[model samples]
Target: MEAKELEAEILRLVREMAPHLLDLLGVGPITAAQVLVSWSHPGRFRSEAAFASFAGVSPIPASSGLTNRHRINRSGYRQLNRALHTVTLIRTRLDPATKIYVARRMAEGKTSRDAQRCLKRTICRQIFKILEPPNRTRAASLTDHANQLDAI
Candidate 1:
């Protein structure tokens, strides 16, 4: 059908646009596109924490009477937050490393929801990295400069 073909084309474009993001463990075509659209320029976020805040996944404090806790965030980009939730579900169910992390966090007295929030923050960091432009290391830049001078 025409709709299926259009969907396939869109997916193809998204894959071509962000192969690195697509390569991530839990990033499907739709999730990658949502992330790319939400974070058109990754540099806009000062840090991964900032990006998580923008996505509405950053933990907010909810401490009460010496008991430390946090409540679910319900602000910021709801679509981006949904995308992150989708990633968390995929990783929690299928990714072994994430499974281990969830178990470890649960052992440390965190509820599954808390553990998932932690995972979403981590996923946001990873998404930021994938979207961020690679900066040349000092040594590499120096070597490139030396090579340019030699060529000159």
Candidate 2:
């Protein structure tokens, strides 16, 4: 299928499963699907470290005798980083808690870029949680049913 066609299908499925979530967020399923597809590549990152690396949020450590410094990791999916940064900015603007969190980070001496990175990491984790299959929970229930059958 074409890109637009696939996106439409994803939107349709999302609408079926979560009509209210989309409505509450003021976004159609197409927009949500686009964001999910941007972050949902399989075999991409196995751990948070890998995800942070891929998102360009992981800090690079630099140290010498009696001196140490950390720099932002810039080598990663620039598109993914841009997407996450954009989401962070939008979330901070719309979510009061996120705005306060950003302010607190700044008060703690974090630069604007550093605070944005922190926001991006939080957004990335939320995206990860949303994309994971709900079937995993149902699978656990199915396993319990099988155990009951064995007990019988």
lDDT of each: 0.83, 0.66
Cα lDDT of model 1 overall?
0.83
Candidate 1 local lDDT, 1-152, one digit each (tens): 99788778768988787788888887887788888889875346666778889999888999999899886677879899999999999988899999999999899999888888888888988888777657734466557667889999
What local lDDT score does residue 89 receive in model 1, on the 0 to 100 scale? 93
Which is the leading candidate under lDDT?
A: 1
Candidate 1: Cα lDDT at 9: 79
Clash counts for all predictions: 0, 0
Best by TM-score: 1
Q: Using Cα atoms with residue i matched to residue i, what is each candidate's TM-score against the true structure? A: 0.81, 0.61
Error of 2 at 11 (Å): 3.1
Residue-by-residue lDDT tens digits, candidate 2, 43-115 = 3345566777777877777668885645667888777777666667667778788889899989987788778
